[model samples]
Target: MPKFIVSLQSNADYEAAKQDIEKQGGSIVDDSMKILGMITVQMSDQSASSLKSLNSGIISVEPDQEVTIQVA
Candidate 1:
């Protein structure tokens, strides 16, 4: 199966979002953050439903930012 790299850029609450991601059935393959409030996340591919849910959750946060999702 193909893979996807979901990157969420925000100064939002990563902890809560991270937890939600797992609960939604996606795994965090890698993640890192910088002091300037930039976060990069790489999550494992999950079911379409799960992926949609995860995206919805992230958008719900309404971070003082936006999310960029890319497939690989």
Candidate 2:
């Protein structure tokens, strides 16, 4: 299985993104956020469609704050 590291801005983003990713067979291995408004999550997936969809809505997704997700 492949792994992905997705970063989200807020709790809502994390939750929504988590749900979406889970639908694509992503297993969240870990997650963390900082006071400066940064969230890091480790996930695993075999497809990219879910991530692509999630990213497409990121701008209007309304996370807690300005955040960045680095998919690894």
Candidate 3:
């Protein structure tokens, strides 16, 4: 399974989004960013795509990646 960051519309229903994700076989990983209208989820690529297409409240579903900074 891959992790993705799901961004929701400002007026989107949070509960509805969660239900949509679960219906697509995805699980919410981190919702700490919900205040910012973002959620981290883990699911298959197909599920991710389905969620994106089926859920109108969702703005974008992007891969979750780590960023590192080096001090010189």
Query: Best candidate, lDDT-wise?
Result: 3
Quote model 1's TM-score: 0.42
Off by over 4 Å in 1: 33-72
Query: What is the C-alpha local distance difference test score of candidate 2?
Result: 0.47
| Worst lDDT 10-window in candidate 3 | 47-56
| lDDT tens digits by residue: candidate 1, 1-72 | 233344344645666666666665545554554333333333444442354455333442211235789999
Model 3 off-target regions past 4 Å?
69-72
Best-matching candidate per TM-score: 3
* lDDT computed for candidate 3: 0.90
Q: What's the lDDT for candidate 1? A: 0.45
- Looking at model 2, residue 5 earns an lDDT score of 47
Candidate 3 is scored at a TM of 0.88
Clashing pairs in 2: none
The CA lDDT at 25 in model 2 is 66
As for model 3, its CA RMSD to the true structure in angstroms is 1.6
Ranking by TM-score: 3, 2, 1
TM-score of 2: 0.47
Model 1: colliding residue pairs: none
lDDT of 2 by residue, 1-72 (tens): 544445444544556666776676656555554333333333343354346556523322122335689999
